[model samples]
Target: MQQLQILSGSWEQFAQDAKLIREQVFIQEQQIAAEDEWDSEDAVSLHFIAYDQGQAIATARLLENNSIGRVAVLKEYRGQGVGRVLMQSIIQLAQQQGRSFVKLSSQVHALPFYASLGFIAEGEEYLDCGIPHMDMRLCF
Candidate 1:
């Protein structure tokens, strides 16, 4: 079973694993600019980390406006429902906050992935961190 825990009990684990995952996927794999990945908005963001077999395998962040971003699951754990757990948590948080919509910038290739989670594309595609992306919103 996967454990959905807030960024509390495992602060170090969260920071390390999240940094590692983001560093790999966003920074290295995707080549997102270093400064682009670290934003001032992180100060008030709510972060969720999922653990499987006692390891932090997935994570995502919820900004104050209910925007979901920086979602990632470890390479070895991809396609195993880890991203599903991360998105599931984000959706629940949006509902709890009485937020009407959840917005996210999805890499062009991952558009269908977000679509599967009920996020519809909005406007034309754009580029961020040198990668093609599109804005997606999910209404609650």
Candidate 2:
């Protein structure tokens, strides 16, 4: 496993690196449309990116409402714990900010991954961008 350096800041601080990973994972790999992949929320959210040996390997963002979204891990780095580490960083930041809870619309297939991180699924699964997803949250 390679050492991963996680950084968090506004979208402008890491838009290039973040977009690269998202495009590869969500657009190119998952076949999500370009319009559905990019959103104005990116400009207002706090973005997180994981760099392995200087290459962006994973990315996620936390919105003002304490909701997390846009999580993507490069195919080559998916099973290497890069996503776990990236999420831990975001969870820790939310705790530091005194947030009551952090929520997300998680892809149905990835439910187990988020559950392992203490997120609980709520409500029925729904389609978002043609993919099944469930609402999940982790209370502080």
- Overall lDDT per candidate, in order of appearance: 0.78, 0.94
Q: TM-score of predicted model 2?
A: 0.98
- Following a full C-alpha superposition, what root-mean-square deviation does model 1 have from the true structure? 2.5
Write model 2 residue lDDT over 97-128, tens digit each, in one string. 99999999999999999999999999999999
Which has the greatest lDDT? 2
User: Which candidate's TM-score is highest?
Assistant: 2
Assess every candidate by TM-score. Answer: 0.87, 0.98
Steric collisions counted per model: 0, 0
Per-residue lDDT tens digits of candidate 1, residues 39-119? Answer: 776566777777786677777888878688888887888887778867877798779878999999998988998999999
lDDT of 1 at 27: 84
